[model samples]
Target: MTKEEAKKKWDLTRKMLEITDDEYNGVTQEDANLRFVKMKLQIAVYYMQLLDEHDSEYQVPWNKEQFKWALRKPVGDKKKQQAKEWCHQCRLMRDKTCTNWNYEEVKTA
Candidate 1:
């Protein structure tokens, strides 16, 4: 998902699930399976946000295997470069470094 889409997603998830950034920080590591499941749902929502924003036809597979595949896919060369620039700009606003280093921005949506 693009950065703006990602931000829009977390805004919704954070509100719906009462999830703060602090909570997300612990989810992926503290309790591996359940948190990962939660993350998958959040990520599905994130990608949906992307689809809405970009008018992309990409479809997300909701099964466990799909989540694994999504997690494995690379950001690609050009998008990776752009994402890094965006990430750096985002990092400047937060005191703590991102745990999800590849796709994080400050919770400022």
Candidate 2:
């Protein structure tokens, strides 16, 4: 899928959730855990195309650093409860631009 396509999807999800509190509590039995899936998807989509390791054009970088940056910490700064918020924001902004790319590749055909 193209960046615009994934971005459209992400925007839709973000619009539905607008606020983190609404997102965390609105979904039943989720307990704020699954609330991050949306933000994670943002990071995933960004990493798939927009990272220094790869050119501006769509290219996948298969390297240890990429894997480490993407997978080492799905939840950034897990030590603090407030950290979840940071993690969600970081991933949403594509701070490392790695998380969702790996997962999307796995789940995709």
Candidate 3:
């Protein structure tokens, strides 16, 4: 099955099983299988949030530059250059050292 199909199946199972964050937190480290399942589900949830087609709320954790970098097509030299620039700008923004990182202006520049 495709990853998306598997994720949908897991989500349905989670809903049917009524798995809650509280339950995951209460589980001890000794229960490795439970912990692993919880971890994997949480990651899958985040991945879905990131890949969601409409109204993605997952962009909050990422800056504009990082989000743009993720959205950039991974093809051709032009896109590759834009991706590299976005990555550099994101790092600079995170470091609080970039004084001239205007999104619209930089995109045209």
Candidate 4:
């Protein structure tokens, strides 16, 4: 898909899921990408179910195991690093030592 299409899909999915700005900001980029993939997988599953309902003998061609795996949230080192940095910055701000603090974290936190 084109970048615009992907972005539109992501935005729509985010809205439908009622993902608040604070919740979205807390996650790493990788986590956001995974959520997008999971949303797409869910949409596919819904479409397949509709097809099944229309025709009882219709079978989904995709492997269910792969879908299950794709739906799982990934744990990664980047997320941990981001969290540590965020905590460090928070501590710095709390101590009034940080001159150039990240405003996004504060807004979301």
lDDT of each: 0.42, 0.42, 0.40, 0.42
Model 4 over residues 1-109: C-alpha lDDT tens digits? Answer: 3334444534643354354465467677666755455444445433333333223233334344643444345734443443334334334334352223366533432
Candidate 3 lDDT over 1-109, as tens digits, reads: 3445545644753453344576556555434344444344344343443233222222223354643443333324443444345444434333342233356533332
Q: Which ten residues in a row have the lowest lDDT in candidate 2?
A: 53-62
In order of TM-score, best first, we have: 4, 1, 2, 3
lDDT of model 4 at position 106: 31
* Candidate 1 TM-score to native: 0.30
Which runs in model 3 stand beyond 4 Å of their true positions? 1-30, 53-109
- What are the per-residue Cα lDDT tens digits for candidate 2 across 1-109? 5545555644653463344666556755343434454455334444443432322233332233533343333433332233244345444444444454566543441
Task: Assess the local accuracy of residue 102 in candidate 2 as a C-alpha lDDT between 0 and 100.
Answer: 68
Stretches of candidate 1 above 4 Å error?
1-10, 17-30, 56-109
TM-score of each: 0.30, 0.27, 0.25, 0.38
RMSD versus native structure for model 1: 12.7
lDDT agreement of model 3 with the native: 0.40
Task: At residue 41, give the lDDT of candidate 4.
Answer: 41
Query: Can you list the residue pairs that collide in candidate 2?
Result: 44-100, 44-101
RMSD vs true structure, all candidates: 12.7, 12.1, 16.2, 18.9
